[model samples]
Target chain A: MNKLLKNSLRFVLFLLVQTLILNQIEIGFGIQLMIYPLFIMLLSFDTGVLSLLAISFTLGICIDAFSNTFGLHTSSLLVFSFLRPVIFKLFDSREGYDLLLEPTVLNMGNGWFIKSFGSLLLIHHFWFYLLEMFKLNDMGYVLQKTVYSLPLSFFLCVLLQYLFVNKQYTK
Target chain B: MRNFIAFIKHFRNVLIFALLQGIALSLYFTFVQFPRTQYLTTAASIQGSILEARNGITKHFNLSKNNVRLQKENIELLEELPKSFIKLEGKLVKIDDTLHRQQYEYIPGIIINSTHSKRENYFTLNIGSSQGIKRGMGVFSTNGIVGVIHNTSEHYAVIKTCLTKKLNTSIMLEKTGQQGFLEWDGVNARKGSMTGVSNDLKIKKWAKVVTRGGGGIFPRGLPVGKISRVEVVEGESLWDLTMIFAEDFRKVQNVYIIKNLLLDEQRDIEKQTDYEDQE
Candidate 1:
C-alpha cells in the first residue's frame, strides 16, 4: 500500500473508532479514553511539524463535530501534536530514530515508548481536562480526572498498536 | 532581511499553534450557547443520516424497557378518555375549552447520538426545523425534562442536556417552592446541584424538584429530579442542594421537542420591560 494511502486509512479508522465506539462508553470518574493522540504519535518521524499540526487539527475537528464537544478535542489534540516533536526529541535514541522505524512500541522499545509517550499523554490529558472543566476551584477535580484517564488512554493506545501494526516492524 | 527571515522561522511554529488554539477555543465558547452553523454538529445531513443508520440497529437493544415506559404512559393518558369514566354531567361545569389556547406543541424525536460523561453533553435528535423544531425549544421524555434545543438544521437538532455547565434552567423544590438554578458538577451524570435554595429552610429529604418555568422554555411542573442531599454553602445564605435526575441520560433514546406557540409574543412583551427600564 502507498504510505500516504495507508496513513489516510489509519486517520479515518481512528476517527470512526473514537467517535462511534469509544466516545459512547461512560465509565464514571472522568475517565475518557482518548486514543486519537496516538495517531499524532504514529505519523512518520520525518513528517514536518506543520503537517503534523494540520493533521491533528483536522482529526480533532472531525471527532469534535461528531461528539458535540465543539472544539475541545481540536484544541487538546493540537497541543498533543505541537508538543510531539519536542517530547520525541527529548527521548531521542542514541543513534537517533531509524528512518525505517515507525513510532510503535515494537520499533521503539517499551522504555523509550513509555518515557516519551507517557509524558506527552500526561500533558495531553492535563490540558484536556483543564480546558474542559475550566474552574480554578476545581483544580483538584481536574488533576483527579487527568490522573485517572491517563493510564486507561495509554493502555488503549498501546493495545491499538499491537493489534493493528504489523509484527514485521520489529525486525 | 536574513535576520528577519530567521525570526519568522523561529517563531512561525508558535504563531501557528497560537492561531489554531485560538480558533478552537473560540469555537468552543461560542457554539456552546448559540450555534451559528450546522456544519460541525450532527445537525448536518451527512452526519445525521449516518447516526440515524447506526441508531436503527442499536435502538432495539432497549426495546423492552422503552416499550414498558411507553405502555405505562399510554395507560395513564388512556385513563383520561371520557369512556374511562362515567360523565358527571349534572355536577361538572362546562366551560369553553377554546378559552385556553394551546401554548405548547410537542414534536416527537429519537436521540440519534448522545454523551453523558463530558463536562457538557449534547444529544442529537432525528428531528429538526423541517418538523417545526427550532432552537431554544425544550426537549423532554415521558419521565422527566431532558434539555433545551441548542441547535437545528433541516432534518436534525441538538439538545443541550442537564449534563452541562451552561444549562442553568430554573427549578424549584416541590414541597417548599424554594427556587434555584440547575447545574452539573461534571463528575457524575446521575447527580447535579442547584444553587440559591436558602440554607435556613428545612428542605425535606427526597422532596421533588420540578421546573420553575421562569424562562417558559419548559412548563411549570415538569419533573426534574428529587433532592438527594442538601448541604449549606459555607459563609452563604444558600443551600448546596444535590439532586438525582429522574431520567437516566445514559439510556435516553427517545424524546419530545417542545414548540412554544406563544414564545414570540412572550419575547415581544418581555422586550417592552427592557424598553421601560431604559426609559
Candidate 2:
C-alpha cells in the first residue's frame, strides 16, 4: 500500500474506533480510553508539522462535536501536535532514525518508544484536563483527572504499540 | 524590517495555530447556545431519534424504580381522595351542583421524557390537551410542585421544571409569613434559593417554607421545602436562603396537573384592572 494512503486509512480508522468503540468503554470510575492520540503518535517522521497540526485540530473538533464539548479537545490536541517535533528531537538517535518508519515498538525499539510516547501522553493529558476545567476553581479536579487518566492511557498506548507493531524492534 | 519578516516566517505555523484556536474558542464561548435552548429546536430532533433507540435499554433498567414510585403515588392518591370528596360534598350542599363539579378535578399523568443535567431542564409528560392538561397549568408530584406547563400538543405537554434558572415561584416562611421569590441557581438539582425575604425574619435551619399564594400559578400553602441554610449579605436587606427539596426530582414518575378553578376569572379581573389604569 502507498505510504500516504496507509497513514490516511489509519487516521480514519483510529477516529472511528476511538469515538465509537473506545469512548463507550468508560472503564469504571471516570477513567476513559483516549486512544485518539494514537493517530498522531503513528505519523512518520517526514510528516509536515503543519499538516500534523491541521489533522490534530480536525480530529479534536470531530471528537468535540460528538461529545458535546466544543473546543476543549481541539485546544489540547493542537498543543500536543505543536510539541511533537520538540519531543521527537529529544529522543532522536545520533545515528538518525529511519524517516519512513513511524514511532512504533517495531521501528523505534521499546525503550526509546516508551520514553517518547510517555512524554507526549503526559503533555496531552495535562493540557486536556487543564482546558476542560478552565476555571481556577476546578484546579483540584483538573489535577486529579490528569493524574488518573495519564498513566492508564500511557499503559494502553504501550500495550497497543506492542501488540500491533512487530517485535523485532524490542532491542 | 528583514529580520522581523524572517521571525514571522520562522513562527508562521504557530501564528496560524493560535489564530485558528482563538476562533474556535470564541465560537465555543459566544456562539454556542445553552444546552436546553438548542435541545428545544434543532438538537431535540436528533436526541429524540437517538433516545428512541436507547429507550428500551433505559426502560428495562428503570422498571423497578418506576414500579415502586407508581405504587407509592397510588397509595397517596387513595388516601387524599376521600378527604377531598368530603370537602367537596359539604360545599355542594350550599352551592349549585353545576358550580360544585367545576371546583374539583384531578388529572393523572406519566413522565414520558425528562432531563435534569442542564442549566435549564425540561420534561415532557404524556398527558396533554386531550387529557385536560392545558398550557400554564401547574404540575406537582405527590411530594410537592414540580413545574408549570409550557407547551402542549394533542397527547403530550412540555414542562419547564423548577430546576430551571428561568423559573421563579413565590414562597414564604410558614412560621413568619416572610415572602420571597424562589429560584434555582443552576447548580444542584435538589436545592434552590429564595430571595427577597426580610433579613429581620428569624429563618432558622430547617424552617418550613411554602407557596405564599401571592401568585395564581400555585395555590397558597403548598409545601415547598425546609430551609437548609440562610445567609444575610453585608449590605443587602434580604436573606439568601437555600431549601432542601422535599420531592426528589430525579425519581419522579407520576405527577398531578393542577387545574385552577378560578384561573380564567382571575385573569379577566387582572385584565380589567389594567384597562381601567389605561383610562
Candidate 3:
C-alpha cells in the first residue's frame, strides 16, 4: 500500500474508533481510554514537527467535535505533538534513528518504544485531565484519573498495534 | 530584517506550538461558559447525523428496557384517562374552563449522543430548530428532569445535562417548600448537590425535591430528585445538601423538550419590574 493512503486510512480508523467506540465505554473512576495518541506516535520518523502539529490539531478537533468537548482534546493533542520531538531526542538510541522507519513497536523494538511512547502518553493523559478539571482543589482527582487511565490506554494502544501493523519481513 | 528572520527561524516550531495551543485553549475556555456556535459541537449536521447513525445501531441494545419503560408510562397515562374513573352522582363537569389555559408544549426527542463522565457533560438530541427546539428550553425524561437545551442547529440540539457544574436549576423540597438551586460536584452522576437552603429547616432523608419554576424554563412541581445526604456548612447558616437524581442519565434515551408558551410574556413583565425598580 502507498504510504500516504495507508496513513490516511489509519487516521480515519483512529478517529472513528476513538469517538464512536472508546468514548462510549465509560467504566467510571474517570478512566477514559484514549488510543488516538497512538496515531501520532506511529507517524514516520522523518515527518516534520510542523506537519505533526497540524495533524494532531486536526485529529483533536475532530474528536472534540464528536464528543462535545469543544477544544479540550485539541489542546491536549497539540501539547502531545509539540513535545513529541523533544521526548524522541531524550530517548534516542546511541546509533540514532532510521529516517525511513515508522515509529511502531514492531520497528522500534520493545524497550525503546516503551520508553518514548510511555512518557508521551503519560504527559498527554496528565495534561488532558488537568485541563479538563482546571482546578487546584481537584488536583487529586486529576492525578487519580491519570494514574488509572495511563496503563489501560497504554495496553490498548499496544494491543491495537499488534493486531493491525504488519511485521517487516527479515528475509 | 535578516536578524529578525533568523530569530523566527530559530523558534519556528515553538511559535507554531504556542499559536495552536492558544487557539485551542481559548476555544475550550470560552465554550465552557457559553456555547456561542454549533459548528464545533455535536449539534452540527454532520456530527449529529453520524451520532444518529451510531445510535440507530446501539439503541437496540437497550431496546427491551426502553420499551418496558415506555409501556409503564403508557399505563400511567392510561390510568389518568376520563374513562378510568366511574361517575357515581352523574354530576356535570365543565370540560373547558376559562380559569386555566395551556402554557407548556412538549416536543419528544431521542438522545443521539451523551457523556456522563466529563466535568461539563453535554447530550446531543436528535431534534432541532426544524422541530421547534430553541435554546434555554427545559428537557426532562419521564422519570425526572434531564437538562436545558444549550445549543441548537437546524436538525439537532445539545443538552446541558445536570451532571455538569453550574446547572443551578431552581428547586424546592417537596415537604417543606424550602427552595434552593441545583449543583453537581463532578464526582457522581447519580448524585448532585443543592445550595441556599437554610440549616435551620429540618429536611427529612429521602424527601422529594421538585422544580420551583421560578425561571419559567421548567414548570413547577416537576420531580427533580430525593434528598440523600445533608451536612451543615462549618461557618455558614446554609445546609450542604446532596440528592440522588431521579433520572439515571446513563440509561436515559427518551426525553421531552418543554416550550413554555408564556415565556416571552413573563420575561417582558419581569423586565418592566426591573425598569421600575431602577427608576
Task: Report model 1's TM-score to 2 decimal places.
Answer: 0.96
lDDT: which is higher, 1 or 3? Answer: 3
lDDT of 1 by residue, B1-279 (tens): 999999989999988999999999999989887888989988888888988888898899899999999999999999997668877676886577986889888888999899888899899999989889878899999989999988899999888999998586999987788899999888888998888888877888899999998797998899999999978899998888899998999888878888788888989999999999999
Q: Candidate 3, residues B1-279: lDDT per residue as tens digits?
A: 999999999999999999999999999999978888899999999999999999999999999999999999999999999888888778767477788999999999999999998888999999999999999999999999999999999999999999888886899998799999999978899999999999887888999999999999999999999999989988999999999999999999999999999999999999999999999
**lDDT per residue as tens, model 3, A72-102:** 9999999898889899999988998888778
Off-target runs (Cα >4 Å) in candidate 2 are: A1-35, A104-115, A156-171, B1-9, B31-59, B74-202, B206-279
Kindly indicate the candidate among 1 and 3 with the higher DockQ. 3
Worst 10 residues of 2 chain A by lDDT: A23-32
Per lDDT, the best of the predicted structures is 3
> Over the stretch A48-83, how does candidate 1's per-residue lDDT look in tens digits?
789988999999999888988899999999999999
Candidate 1 regions exceeding 4 Å error are A168-171, B88-96
In DockQ terms, which candidate is top?
3
TM-score for each model: 0.96, 0.60, 0.98
Candidate 1 deviation (Cα RMSD): 1.9
TM-score of 2: 0.60
Q: State the DockQ, from 0 to 1, for candidate 1.
A: 0.82
Q: Considering lDDT, which of the candidate structures 1 and 2 is the better prediction for this target?
A: 1
